[model samples]
Structures are given as C-alpha cells and as structure tokens.
Target: MFKKAFMSLALLLISALSWGQGNPVHFTVAQKQVSPSEVDVVFTGTINNGWHVYSTALPDGGPISASLNVEKAVGAKAEGPLRHSGKEINIDDPIFGMRVRYFEHHVQFVQRFKITGKTYSINGYLEYGTCNDEMCMPPQSVDFNYKGNGPKDAPAATDETAAATADDASPADSAAATPAGEAQDSVAAAAQAQPADTATASIGDQLWTPVIDKMKAYQPDTEGKSLWYIFLMGLLGGIIALFTPCVWPIIPMTVSFFLHRSGEKGKGVRDAIIYGISIIIIYMTLALVITALFGPQTLNEMSTNAPFNIFFFLLLVVFALSFFGMFELALPSSWGNKVDSKASATTGLLSIFLMAFTLSLVSFSCTAPVVGLLLVQAATSNNWVAPAIGMFGFALALALPFTLFAMFPSWMKKAPKSGSWMNTVKVVLGFVELAFSLKFFSVADLAYGWGLLDRETFLALWIAIFTLMGLYLLGILHFRSDGDNPKAQPVACIMLGLCSLAFAVYMVPGLWGAPCKAVSAFAPPMYTQDFNLNKTEEVKAKYTSYEEGMAAAKAQHKPVMLDFTGFGCVNCRKMEAAVWTDPEVQKRLNDDYVLISLYVDDKTPLAKPIEVKDSKGNTRKLRTVGDKWSWLEQTKFGYLAQPYYVTLDNNGMPLSGSFVYKEDIPGFLEFLDNGLKEYKKR
Candidate 1:
C-alpha cells in the first residue's frame, strides 16, 4: 500500500523533473576585432525546437536571466556590460508570474573588450536559463576564449554604440574583413580540430573523469511507461464510472435493447458485440478529433498555461457542485432525442452506433467530469497518442459489461442493483473532484504569482474536505442529496470512511508544514508554507566538491553517492521528503555511502569561471558553483536532469546503475545496495 502511494505521488510529480533530459540549447563563441585595440566577443546560441532562453535584462523574482562573465583577462579590460542581438520576446510569463524577456530559436550575446598589449587574451562564459512549455532546465553555461595580437597601427576611436550595435549588421562579416579576427577564428577552428589528448593537456589535469560508457550501460528504460500508466488510470476511472448512477442503470437497458432486437440469442449477442464496438469507436474518434484539433504541443501548452488552468479549475468546480446535487448537468434534450429517433428509425450497424451515442449522451453528467479529468492528464503527458490511448481504455472498460452480459445472460442476475447507494458514490466523487480542483487552481496561482493558495492553506482545505467526506461516508453527516434518512453503511463504506479520516489526520500535520509525503505532489511546495516545524536532520553530504568528495570516499573506503539535484526541482524535494527521509534509506546513505549533492540551480557565483569539456567533447565554462557541478554531472554521467543519483568508486568509476526522479524507497535502497555490493566485490 505504501509503495503504491509512493508510486502514485511519483506519477503526479513526474512532469516536474522529467524535462531538460538532454541538451536543449547549443552554443558557439567567436571574436571580431572592431578596432585596433578592441574586439567583440560574440556568443551565439541555437536553441532546440519548443525551448527558449531568458534574456539578461530581467527583474528579480523571475526566471534566471542570461549574463556574460569574464573569468580571466590578460592585457585587456571589458569595455562595458554584455549586449545581445535584440531579437527577444517579452511577455507576461505564466510560469514565473512576472513579465519576462527571452529568446527563442537563436540569440547572440556580445561583449567588447579593449586590448592594452601587443598580445591579448580573454576567457569567460555565458550563463542562461531555458524552458519549454512543460518544464524548465537548470541554469546553463557556455565558455568563450580569445587570443590574438593587437594591430600595429593605432586607429581612431570608434563610436562604442556604433561598434556594439553591430548586432544589426554581421559581426562575422567584420571578423572576416580584419586580419586579427581572421587569425583568431582560424586559431579557434584549429583548437576545436585538435586531438583530444592535446586539448586535454592544454586544459590541465581533469577534475572529474568521464563515466559515460558505464552510465550508458545502465540507462533506465522509461519509454512507454507514461502511456501504460495513462491507460491504467483511465481504466480505473472507467471502473469508477461503472459504479456511478449515470452509467450503472444503462447497462441492463443496453443489454435489453440488444436482446429485444432479435428473437434468436445468437443474433442478439452479435448485435450486442457490434454495440460495444460502436462505443469504443465513438470514444476513440472523440480522442482523435481532439488530437487533430489541437495537436500534442498545444495540448501540452494548455496544461501549464495560466488562463486555461483557471478555466479548467472553474469547470471542475462546477462539475463537483453538480455531483453534489446542486444542479443537474445534461446535454441538450434535443440532441439525445435526435440520436434516439435515429436509432429507432435505422435498421443496421448505423442504428447500433446511434444507440451507443444515445447512451453516451444520457450519461454525460457523470462521464463528462471523469473524461475531462482524464484528458487533462493525458494532455500533460506531452505524447500525441496519450489522449486516444486513455480514451481507448475508458471505452474498453465502459463497453466490457454489455458484451459480457450478452455472452452470459445468466450472469446479469449477479450484478448489483442501482440504488440510493449510487447517490452516495456520486457525492463521494464530488468531494474528490472538489479536492482536485484546487490542484489546477494552484497551478494557475503559482504561474500568475498569486499568493492565494499557499501550502498551509491548501492543506487546511484538503483536511476539511476529506473530514467532511469521511463524515458523509460514515452517516455522521448528510448532504442535501442524502435525503432525510441515512442508508445502512456497508463494510466497504465503513472502511473507506475510516481511510478518509485517516488521510485527514495524516494531513493535519501538514498545516504546520509537515512533509506529509502522501500529498507532496498535490500540495503546493513546502517553500510556500508560511509556518513550518517539521524539519528533520538533513543527511549532510561529506563534501560538496567532486574532488574533495572523491578524496574523502577513498579515505573512508566507501562508495560516493553523487546526487545531481536542483533547488527548482520539485521531484527532488519529493524524493528527499518521501524516499531519503526513510529510516532505511537515511541509514544506507549516511553509513554505507558517502553522499555528495550537487545542486545545478545554485546561484552562488564562483570566484572565477573555469574552462571544461563535457563528455560529448563540447568545450564550456563553469561560472558558478552550480555550473561546476552541473558540468561535472553532464561530463561524467551525460545527464542534465535531476534528481539524478549514481554511485561511484573513489576513482570516479560508476559502481552500479543510475537513478532519476523516482519516489520508490525500496528501489532506491536496492540501487544503494547494488552499488555497495559492487564496491565490496572490488
């Protein structure tokens, strides 16, 4: 049960840490001599499709803004702050809840420096932030270098703005026109074309060794998991829908309609089969139409878009109120009448299809909410076929009973009769929808930077909702729909009430900022909590620096647990709250392994940037503590996403498999155990 709970939470928070899996932006740097003693260092970034980088000129409390930092300069001094090519997008960002400026597709940053010597050189890096519609990447960096001889003749000073604004023109053209720029470009090309060993020698001793080959050998297979999970969730919803008052009564009527259509049992069974097929076709076709209308990318955008989330929140609240018996929600009576008349008039497969359509229309109130919630989830999956796949499962489960009853007519006697108990089911579902509606609203609130729904407030509301649901289930409370007298509470009802009460109790502590790991994915982040007292003793890492951690690991004769994480990573916090806090996991991490957590989103700048090459042989610069660790993770394990965990020996060789953004405690323990076992073997 605990495992299942954890898995569910993991699935809920999957989107938080699943993005930035690979490099979404590529960068190159070059130099152009604009004057005899001055040069323009141009940095160009080519962002991948559907991703963007924030601009350098943005206010605080927003996404990370791009900036240029010069780590080392010899015989030169920076003329001014960095400038960009000016093609930027300015918008009121939903995710950050602020007005932001960013660049998509391609952008360039240029810095001008004045040379004071016959030979001059400069070294620096560009720092930026990136995100797609679904999620954001950690802060990223790219390195730049230039070395050249100053022109012999001293030329008159040029207008700084005129030279800097060369962004309007081509800096490359100027670079090719000048001897110095041409020389520098040739040198850069030569450097890039140099042998790996020579380049390595130039960079000095490597701080961390690459383990890409070993890491690749143990990459996790995550493909198809989302679609399977979506299908199963849809199936669960379908099963729940079957118990609703809207759908349960239709089963027998549908079967009877088929039986009355023909005198022979075989003919009736064949017609019922066709009816079931029609239901599947109708639902799947709906999914296809939705996909065709919006496509996957737009659907993904809608999932996180603020206005759409707000709209969905209101829609769900209305659905929940309807389920609470405030008012009935029905399709137009005329539409159902039209379909019913069509079914009555026709005499073939078309008639059977119309009958299925009529049943769908009649059940709209109950099924629409469930279907809407399912499709919303599928949209967030970022998969084109997810909606269709989800609908297929829902349709299969909804259609299964009619086909089954037709095959075994006697089994119909065993089916439970619908009653006031169905109303109870609907009200309970109302409570659930009401609770979930807050999740959508919270997304919009966070995106718009609205402080209306903080962690404590969200928890308090959930606690109240569930407590009332428990009371309703236990017959201690009644809704307007419950009528005057309470029905006899069945064993399942009692069990569910107790469970609901238990869950409410569990969340009570969350009001004061408890982890309440069960709802970590649903609740607003802990950072949003106004008051928190549930702090645990954090499992401190022995060292934060890779070299120091490795030295300590070697001295202690223990494996190093390299934790590539980020402050902005939601699933990292989930794992820390739900998995690392486990007694067994804590003990294993503290005692059996030396932990080293590298936060890729840390903003503390380094004393000076350092040049390095990733495992993919791309040269870049590390300008901050975050940059250093982030580069190490990419260079060694070839993973940019977090919370990434991999165990390594003292020599920096991978000991076992890698782990990323999962809330499975036992699986994490197994990963630790495997690494430990492998270390012991050595």
Candidate 2:
C-alpha cells in the first residue's frame, strides 16, 4: 500500500506539471497613497513553480525588462523615482547558457509623487515577461489605477471604520521606503498649493518628451500579424503594377524578342519558362539573405527605433518623388548590359539565367521602389518566412504574365500599349507612399512625446494627400500633363473619382470628432482632438474616480480590458472601422466590459508618478500619458506598438485564454463572454 501510494503521488506531480504548462503568468497591481503628494505603486507577480518573471533591471541581451507608467491629475508632481524591492533570484538560463538574475514569488516597485490639486486620478499599466525553465510566453500587461483627495476633503473621524481599515499601512512604513508617507504628503500639499504649469505645455515644452514621443510616433503599425496577408498584399501590388505603362509595353516587346531569338514558338515557350524560374530564384534569394541577416528580434526592434523610422520616412518620400517623375532610380547600365551581352554569347541554362537577371536589373527604375517597399514590409512582420514568401508571391505575379503571353503569342495584339497613363499610375502610388511616410513620423512623435502631430493634424494631412490624389486622378492636378480636362478613359475617371470621394468622406468625419474609428489606429488619440463627440457626459460619469472603479472591479471579479490604443495606429483605426463595427462584436464589448482606453500617443503629461522600468531595467519617470502606456506595453506585453488589448480578473490575474488581437474581434468577444459565463457559473 505504501509503494502504491508513492507511485500515485509521483503520477499526480507529473499531471500537475502538464496542466501548468498551459497556465499564463499572474500579474497584479497594488497602489498606496503615501501622502497627499506621493503614491507607491507595487507590481506583484506570482509565477507557477517552473516559471519566473524577469526583474525590472535585466542584464544586457536578456528578454524585455519590466516597466510601469502612471497617469496623474493636472497640477500634481511626482517626487523621486520608481524603485524595486524584493529578493532577486539568480539562476543559470539554459537557453543562453548563462547565469541570470530575476524575480519570483513576489516583487514590488514603488514610486512617490507630490499632489498639486484638490483631487486627481492616476492610471496606467505594468508591462512584463513570463518565462519558465523552458519557453517564454508572449509579454503581457495589467492596468492599475489609484486616486487621492486633498486635505480639505479628509474623511470625518469614525472609530469603528478606522479600526476596520487599520490593516492598511502608510506607504512610508512599507519595506521599500524609510519615510515614504511624510515625504509623499508634503509633495501632495505642495502640488495642491502651487499647481504645476507643465500640464498645459505642449510636448515640445520638454526635452525628454520629444525623445519619448519620437519612439512612440515612429513604431511600425504592421509587424506582428498573419504572414498570408503580407504576401497577398505584395502579390496584389505586383498585379496592379503590371497594368502600368512602364512594364505594359515591355510585355509584347520581350515576347517578340524571345520569339525571334528562339526562331520557333516551341523553343520560345521553353526559354520563357526558364526565365520565369530564374526571376523567382533571384528575388527569393534576396529576401532570404535579408531574413538570415536580421532575424525576427532585430526586425521587431527596428519597428520601434526612432532613427530607423525617420530614415524609412525619408526613404519613402524619396520614392514618392521619384515616382512623380522628379528623377528615375536606375542601376548602372554596365552591370545589366554586361549580363545581357553574356546571355547572347552563351547558350543553354547559363544563358537563360543571365538573361533573366539582366531583365530584372534593367527594369530597376520601374520595379525597384515597389519591390523595396514590399521587402521592408515583409521584414517588419513577425514570421521568419514572410519576406521570402512575399517575394515569391511578387515574383510569381511578375513572371506569370510573361509565361502566359509567350504560350499564347497570337493574343499579343489585344494587350494595352505603354503611354501617359503609366505616368498617372506612378504618380498615384507616389501619393500613397507619401501618406504612409507620415505614419513613421507619427510613431517617432508619439514615442518621444513630441506634440508636433496630433490626431487632427495627422488626419488633416491625410485628407490633403488623398484629396490631391483624387484631383490628380481626375486630371485636375497634372504633373506631366496639362489641366483638369476629362480626357482620361471612363473607367479610370470613375475609379479615381470614387476613391477620392471615399477618402475625403473618411477625413470629413474626423474633423467633426467622430472616432473616425476606421483609421483610429493611425490617428492620434481622440482625447488629443480639440473637440470630440465621443467624450460626452455619460462617458465621464462611468469612472469618476480610479479607486471606486478599481474596487468595484475587484468586488465583482470581472476581467478588466485595458486597451492601449492610438488614433495614429492605422491598424487600430482599421479595427474600429472594420472589425468593431460588427454588431455582435460591438455589443459584447460595450455591454459586459470595463473598457479603459489608454492612448499611448497622447501628448498630455500626468502631474504625478507614472514611473516604470524600461526594457533596459532603468527607472523611467513618465511625463505624458503616452509614455505610461507605451512603457507598460513594452514591459508587460513585450510589444512596443499599439492597438493592444489585455484582460485581467478583478484580483489582477489574467483570465485564462484571455489575450487577443483586434483582427480577431469575434474571437476576442467570445473569449470575454466565455470568461463572463465562467464567472457567473462560479
């Protein structure tokens, strides 16, 4: 019986380990107001036996470090910086084969602030990572809020209630601080007496704000998503360009040249087949080399780096100008010319490959920018094979036409000739490139807290770009040709007019303060708008004080939805416009939810301690609302970009199977509804 019992216990241990594998990390936020002036924010992480949470401070080359952000009321001033207190654990990581120190069981981070107003609310989230002895789970975040009232509103003395709440210790008594309570109260009183003027200042008013805004503004909007979509977009772009004037004329000429060189339809067909394969191999190789060099982590880091974003913005602008006929981007003719000469001199497979390479190099002026754009997009994506897959799709699109036309040479007469219309197509794409360039600039602005471009400003710029593009399409504004005459073909005219009108309509609502939800991702926060229809009295009343709402959420045991979104996140806007509009999805989110929309790109700074540890493990004091959320996203979710949604139970535990993306709106809602059902059942 003893042996049997021991065997059963061992079996149970193995079962528990298997069950824990699917469990997510536990994240909780506990806030204490040390004084009227200062607040202490603590993040308590409980990892399963095998899992460990990294410290706010991590050594170089480790996974993302923990981070925090606080949103304070106007006139409040945060005192000192955020500090971490806990027993740090040292362990040897098998993955890196190095010893690393982190935290487990429980850890607390504290920040002190001075209040400047009679009343104010502080809000933000904690960003962190969870990894076990094995693999690391995706980074995640949990929202937190704390509110304080001024001395004038101190509660009347009540012996019974005082005793009941006596368990609450002053922030100063906490192990993290020696005299935290008195220091915090003094700061709060000072803030209340002389409200800080920094609240009203634009982001440019501060030096550090610009740095944070720059990082936020320039992050790539599309880095982590389905690979199929990236490849499909490239393929579609290629197909559309095939109809452009630059390459259309070559279709027939190239086929005729091959027919003459081969001397027969059968031989011409075979040569065309070989050329198509050669094109695929060449483009795929280029994509492979890029992926092999950069890797996913480096590519993801590039998505948020300010300098990279600025460079990309400038690069796209150059491409746009080139497309508008400012100048052509051509490869040195000597290289392609030499390859062409060799192809003529040689026969067989080597000749075929050389001829294919020559055609690609020779067409650099027309296809290079498009290819470059596609490659850049693919590189930023999460999938390792995305770049290669996208290039393969693009090459296929470019090659299929050549191969098909070769097989059916008699149908060549029906093909359209290259003409002025090709210039129009190039110019239209230029407008698109110019518009996309702004997105990068917006990321830089938000990351560094620069107030150069707000939601309205970004929308206004897009409106102008699309409006001008429409006019150009309708022959209103010509680059190479004259006046707005209706000389263009009927189909092209209608297509241009409709596209222009649609985009213009989209921008019009934005000016009026509509969520313009469709493009919310790319726009700045709605709060950044000088006027907003969505910010009505009803919305204001939903959460009058952070404390009350937090208490209620805790009592009810409902998962909180902390939405780190931005108006400038094109993906966020797309989600609002396309996904959230679905009736079923909308109802679930609006009715059974505690939705806290925290705009990471907002230029508004908090008056109190929005202190967070950056990915590097240094304490970062947040000045703007964006800084808080951005830090939270990076530290917790291991994500630096926006339109991120996180759900946590009242106790701050993430609901089982609760993480979701905007694209999976239906799934997201289902996940929430299922959680609600489970709660109700309990």
Candidate 3:
C-alpha cells in the first residue's frame, strides 16, 4: 500500500512538469560601432517563437519594461535613453484590465556613450520581463561588460557571471544597480556545487561540444487570402450586383443607346465594345489610385484593428438597413443630368466614353456599396494587386452584359424579367451582410482576449442567425417588401435554406465542446471551453518542470524523454492531440519514461537571469524559463529547434537518439522502445 501510494504521488509530480509554450529568450550585448571619440553599445534579445517580452514602457501595475542601467567608467559619459527598434505592440489585457506594450521575436537596443581616447571599461545591466499566452515571469537583470580597446571580434559584451539566483541579490546602487560583489560571489559558490550537465551552473572551465545545426519546420502562415481568391471573390460580388434592381435596368438602356448612335452595324458594335472597355479602365484606375494612396499594409492593419472593425460594423449595418428599405441612398439628379448632357453634346469616341461614365455615376447609389465592400476585401487579402484585380473582375462583369446584348440583341429577350425577384436578391444580400458583420466583432474579441465571444457564444449567435435566414428563405418569415400573401419559395431559395439549416445542425455539437474542425478557423480556440465531457482517464504521467521531473526520474530509476515543444506550435499540438493521444503511445510514454516537456517559446522568466559562456566563449544571458531550457538543449545536445525529443538515462546521459517532428505514431513508438532498450542495457 505504501509503495502504491508513493508511485501514484510520483506519477502526479512527473505529469505536472511537461506543460510548455515555445518561447525562450537570450540576450547578447555588443558594440555596434567603435571609434576614438565614442562607441555605441548594442543589446539584442533573441526570443524564440510564440513569446514576447515587455518593451521600455508600461502602465502602473503592468509588467516591467526593458531598461538599461550603466555604471560609471572613466573618460566616458552615457548619452540618451536606450533606443529600441520595431514598433511596440500595445495590447490591452482582458485579464489585467490595463494596456501594455511588448516586443516579440527579436529586439535591439542602442546606447551611445561619449568617450575619450584613453582606455576604459564600461559595465551595465538590462532589466526586462517575458510573457506568453499562459503566464508572466518577474523581471530579470542581465549584466554586461565592455572594453574600450577590445578585439575586433570580442567574444561577447555580456559578463555571463550575473545570473538569476534562488536568493535575492542586492542591487549595486541607485545609478548602476547590477548585483553587488558579495551577491555575485554567493551565486558563483552555489553554482559550483551543481552537476556540470545542468544549464544553471556558475563557475566552470568545462569542455563543450559545438551546437548541432538543424533546420526548423516551415511554420505555415494562417493570415490573408490568395490574390486569385480575392479576384474570384470580387467576381462573385460583381455577379450578385449585376442582378440587383439598381444595375439590371441600366443594361438594356445602355445597349439601346449604342445601337441608336450609329446606323452602320460594325461602327455600333465597335462603339459598344469601346464603351464597355472605358468602364473597365475607369474603375481599374480608381483602384490603382486607392492602393497608391492608402498602401497595402494599411488595409491589413485595418482587418484586425478594433476601432476600424467597429467602424466597419456600423457602416455595414447602415448598408444592410438601406437594403431593408429603411431609406434610399441616391445621388442628386442634377449631377446625372449634367453628365447625360455632356454625353449628348459630345461626338465620336468621346461621346460613347462620356455615356459610359454617365451610367457609372448614375448607378453610384447601388454600386458604391458593392465597390466599397470589394475594396475592403482586397485590403484584407495582403496582396499588392488585389484591389486592381478585384476592380477588373467587378468591371468585367458589370460591363459584359451591355456589350453582349448590343452585339446580339436577341439574347436580351432571354434575360430574366426584372421584378420582385430583384428585391428578394437584395434582401438575401442584406442578411449575408448582417451575418458577416459579426466577424469583425469576433476579431475584436480575440485580440483583446475578451470572453464576450467565446467559442460557444459565437457559434450560438451564428446558428441563430443562419436559422432565421433559412426560415426567411422558406417564406415562413417576411421582410418589409414581401407581399401580404407570400409566393411559394423558388428551388434556388429552397436549396440555400436546406444548406443553412444543415450548417446550423452541424454546429450544435460545437456548443458541447466538439473539435468543430469545419468552423475552427472562425471560432475561438478550444482551451476556452469551460465545460467539457471528454475529460477522463488520459495521459497524465508527464512532467511540467525540469528539476522536479529530474528528481522523480532518478528516484524511479527510469529514463527521461525531454520533449522540447511550444504552446504556440501547431505541429506540437497536433502531436499531442493526434499522435500522443494514441493508446499505445500514451501507455509507452506513461510507463516507460519520465517525460520532461520544455517549451522553447515560454515567456515566463526565471527568478533571475542565468549568465553563462557557451563553447565559443561568447557570454549568453538566459533570462526566461524557456531560456534556461533552451540553454540546456543547446549545451547538452547542440541543437536549437522544437519539437526535439531526446531520451536520457537516469544519470542524464543520452540513451538512444533524438527525434524531431516525426508525427507518425509507429515511428515514435519505435524511438521510445529503442531508447527504453538502451536504458535497460545500461
């Protein structure tokens, strides 16, 4: 009974340590430029994927921002505040209820201090904190040392001796607050007692191997649409617009004018085609001008921007209301009359071109909204030519009908009679506009991390909206324009109603925490699920932290499988949700080894920074939780990418092999079995 209880306790402890996010960060300081007059001190932080550290500014009660505190050196005077590159990310935390600014991936700081020709050594330290989706770590300080006449390729500017420690180290003074000499001594002494294999070791002249270079996986970008996709979307919008009441009637009138303008059939056909071409050129030129003025990135920024999204929400609402017969949005008749007079007064090609321009300006009320919608779509596409491509498609479809009917007037008889169906189409488009407007709200919800539009909430709202839309399609519901006695629904409306109903039914399981892969891209992540039925006896025998995991693995006389992974890593999650969830793989992982999962991108900082010299004698400061783990991986195995899996015996010696992103279950099983066999032999 005692042994069983101990085993259960051990399993629980081991399982808690394997949790991870991918971010790990390291800092290196250097001299950007050296001269007799002065030198530029540069500090660079190389942060791993999925994590971010605070910038040099933050509100009260928020995380600490990066700060550079330099100590006095003869013949040198520090100049200016530390200047960092990159636009600071200002985010409003839903949890903390405050705004914060941070830097991600990589950050650079430049500090220029005036100096004389006389030699001098400068010392300083940088203070910063890191955070990821999970949590935040306390701020840490990493010290640096620089020589006036240092070698061209001086190993590193960082001291590599002022590392974070278990105990507090008193700051030097108000101006230069690097830890005191006594504190550094104590830290070094304590570090000497640890095993050499550990990453946190203090003073050592240890032999080290070169880092093994490995190609990282090509992370797929989930944002933006393809250019061709944008063009097709614009084409779809144009086709829909062609059927609207505002533009359908103009087709016959425009074609009739071209036919009456000239008696020669060839001249009439040529003029009609030229008129259509003129419309295309006009719209395409407008699109180009918009792109040049606003720039492509501005559109991309507006896509997820909160204020812009809100503005869009309101604008779309107004458009939908207009379609619902709230009021007509029209251009002044005087403007149209003047353009018509210009067309009548002009002659030759100019007359035909003026007429085409007149139709565009006349149809602005109905076509403007559609054009604006297409341009907005183009902006979100992240393509330079998307706007132009969109306009080309829109203009092509808009102009084609007039040209075709003018060329062959007989086809005009086949055109569907413009009547009540046009209003139905408008009403249907209004419903679509209302439904999609919610997407901007969803983007705001995710960006601000607000719980207002959680997965279930968003899904529920969509289900209700689509259900109502389906009802309307079935003629069970009526809009403002519907007659007192509704006509039977058309086959087209019936088919759409069935699709909407089916989609709503499919989303029902998502309310109960289903994966909902079909709509996953639009919905919030699954972790937001407050209630889930799938939670049961599962793989819980993993570790969350390295020291605790190591202690347990050694006591249990089992090998350790170091799973280098990240929370923001999709492939890592895929492995967990798919491969690791396999019964055989779970059993093997649970029974065979102590799994110590470390996230290379975790932003949680250590209690203090750990400074160490690598094999090349370059001073590296490991500041965050991920930094410590990454240091171990690089030093021990000589590699720097996740999901790097290594099998280590109880004594922390490599047993069999290291694996990287082999997603197949059988392959992973073979790796585990081989490592276990090697461990048993040892």
Q: Which lDDT values do the candidates have, in the order given?
A: 0.73, 0.58, 0.64
Whose TM-score is greatest here? 1
Clash pairs detected, candidate 1: none
Superposed Cα deviation of residue 23, candidate 3 (Å): 15
lDDT winner between 2 and 3, please give it. Answer: 3
Question: Which model, 1 or 2, shows the larger TM-score?
Answer: 1
Among all candidates shown, the one with the greatest lDDT: 1
Sort by lDDT, best first: 1, 3, 2
Model 1 has an lDDT value of 0.73
Deviation in angstroms for 301 in model 1? 4.4
Question: TM-scores across all candidates?
Answer: 0.74, 0.57, 0.61
The window of 10 residues in a row where model 3 has the poorest summed lDDT is 9-18
Q: Backbone clashes per model, in order?
A: 0, 65, 19
Model 1, span 58-173: residue lDDT tens: 65435556766555666666776668885787776433346777887899888788876666767766777786543456777677777878766534333333433343223322
Considering TM-score, which of the candidate structures 2 and 3 is the better prediction for this target?
A: 3
The list of candidate 3 runs beyond 4 A from truth reads 1-122, 125-225, 483-486, 529-682
Cα misplacement distance, residue 175 of candidate 3 (Å): 21
